[model samples]
Target: MTTPRLEGRIAVITGGASGIGQAVAQRFAEEGADILLTDLAPCDATVALVQGLGRKAHQMRMDATSEADCDRMVEMAVQVFGRIDVAVFSAGVKTLPEAPRPGVDPAKATQLVHMSVENFRKVIDVNVTGVMLGSRAVARQMLAQGTGGAIVNIASTAGRIPLAGGGSYCVSKAGVIMLTKVMALELAQTGIRVNAVGPGYTSTPMWDAPEDSDAYRRAMSITPMQRNGTPREQADACLYLACDESSFMTGQTLHPAGGQFTG
Candidate 1:
């Protein structure tokens, strides 16, 4: 039998309820890692999927934005599986405030200037602040254990480019990119590696769009690959970062944008 890459490891995944998070959980479980799934939304589906893979799985409804919740989730992971070998911060808000409505022209839709502070702040709070809290909590546990760990933050290609109507999301992901670097540098001695994966135009429910829709066409125009990325592709990148395969790497971002943003 072929041994799994993550055999005997434990992972804590936030935003485990859906999309990229759900994909990662499934992949990690298949690789022989038990999962501790937490999210603001119900994660029964993901938990069941992971468990079906024959790996132990646990779930907790958590607000990633809450410092207390982040810490508690990490604690719960350790309690359930002894220790956390990897952490994937995939919990975040979509770049666009809302999906394109049918027959609505995105170009003529609400612009940034008309966007509300409430919406912008909410994105930052959940995306940037949540990353900070989760990374910190995971690092703390790793430090206590004295056995270094891995943290993979899910950034976006928009972080490396200027999105016309995605200023808030771009800014937040940019923050995540830099934060990953800073944490990586500070924790190098402790053996905790921090990195990010920047995905471009992934086909997720958050950005629901038909292939013939303008929304999909617009995304394809900017992407050099002329195609949308899949959640599994992003999950694979996270798997690389979370596993010992990238042990020598730290403070780096793996962009799986299909040539969208080379940087």
Candidate 2:
């Protein structure tokens, strides 16, 4: 029951401003890891949260899809923390049925089939390419450090099974799962591990219509747990997969999926 499993390690978490990403940063800090959190905009709030937990941390703005941004974020973490033992790709955007923004909602404003091609490409780029860039960038530094490390990508159960309204999101997550396997193979020589977390119906603010979202509730109903999982539970799973406790594990997906995906 030692709480400091990650004492002295440095971890960089992207998309740490909200949802599962935020939870992971907080939990990692609690485990004694010095952290760096980045998001599309400023990560000030996440920075404050981690520091409030009595751990050292810094925040940066990053767009994971940009190689330059990803590299910069990793470089800053290494410079500040001296090394990067872990990198977690947890930033993602979703496409809900009732999205109000023209870019987000397909059916709104009678734009179902009329949605911009740019919007679809944006979702795929951020969700899939973003994970790849972050993982690869941090891995290079880890290889140079030559101590080996871990990388965790946040994927969804939607990738495992499917969600009716999660068009591009589902595709993007599926790509993430595959990318993990590929990266794991390529990085094995360095003792670096690559893995993914497939979250079930998680009870996070990211679930568009929270209390009354029928589509979200419908996803939960199929779970054997019969309820949504909390961010902390999923965060713990991410922590386990990120730590040496899972030393024998690599190139696989750890599902905190509430029995939702029998596969």
Give the number of the best model, judged by lDDT. Answer: 1
TM-score, candidate number 2: 0.90
Report how far residue 172 has shifted in candidate 2, in Å: 0.5
Q: Scored by CA lDDT, what does every candidate get?
A: 0.90, 0.84
Worst 10 residues of 1 by lDDT: 107-116
* CA RMSD per model (angstroms): 3.1, 3.1
Could you tell me the TM-score of candidate 1? 0.93
Task: Give residue 143's error in model 2 in angstroms.
Answer: 0.7
Off by over 4 Å in 2: 1-3, 96-115
lDDT of 1 by residue, 134-247 (tens): 999999999999989999999998788887778889989999999999999999999999999988888887767888998888888888888888999999999999998899
Candidate 1 residue 93 Cα shift, in angstroms, is 0.6
lDDT of 2 by residue, 166-230 (tens): 66678788999999999999988889999999888787767644656777568767788767888
Residue 216, model 1: Cα distance from true site in angstroms: 1.1
